[model samples]
Target: MTIDTQSQRAEHSPLRRIFGSVFAILQTRLELIGIELAEEKDRLLGVLFLGLDAMMLATMALIALTALVAIAFWDTYRWQSLAGITVVYAIAALVCALKARNGLVNSPIVFEATLAEFEKDREIFRKP
Candidate 1:
């Protein structure tokens, strides 16, 4: 029996070439998108951590400053020192409370982006 290599190659050459090209493009696109998403996730986490660290440092600084000021005023008028410390604490607490509230407000934006990504992945997979 003669092997019909020429006929088989002719029938499949164009289709196989086109399919290989399409698959290569799709794979490249998927890899690029994954890398971008990873970078974005890293950046988001870094920002969140920085914000948290700043808030913590600010809180500590406020407390330390108030204590120092209170000690300085303690010999003159204990009431004045106590009042100053109280005001400092109040202001710091108010700021921290507002920041906590803002964090809650910003969470929805993050959730929306996450949900959108999930939807896109779902759609991609659902497509034949």
Candidate 2:
């Protein structure tokens, strides 16, 4: 009975070790995915807040400047001044929108490191 038990354990040991290694690798990959997700979320939030603040301040400034320009030209070129300001604001808005679209389209793939790590794991396991 003692000899049989020793043989059984010896036969199962390699399987157990393989399973342990696989589980460890899986756990590490999961941790890396979690970390990447957190970083991406923080970055997106920061960009959102900063963009909102910039838009808000820029709008306030534009409104104030528009009022000042209109008041300054109230006698002679009031209409032309307002129309020019409107045209300039429209062009600026279009440029900003295009830049934002390009930024989103060109942004790096999310979880790139996690994908690379998974690829490495696949390569490691594929070896003979």
For each candidate in turn, the TM-score is: 0.49, 0.92
Candidate 1: pairs in clash: none
Question: What lDDT is reached at residue 93 by model 2?
Answer: 93
Clashes of each: 0, 0
lDDT of 1 at 90: 88
Q: Residue 21 of model 1: what lDDT?
A: 72
Candidate 2 lDDT, 1-128, residue by residue in tens? 99999999999999999999999999999999999999999999999999899989999999999999999999999999999999999999999999999998999999899999999999999999
What tens-digit string does per-residue lDDT give for candidate 1 at 24-127?
75676566667768877998899999989997998899778877877888788878878867886789779979998998787644344445655775687689
Q: Which segments of candidate 1 are over 4 A away from where they belong?
A: 1-4, 65-128
lDDT of 2 at 30: 97
Alpha-carbon runs more than 4 Å astray in model 2? none
Please report the candidate that would top TM-score against the real structure. Answer: 2
**Alpha-carbon lDDT of model 1:** 0.77
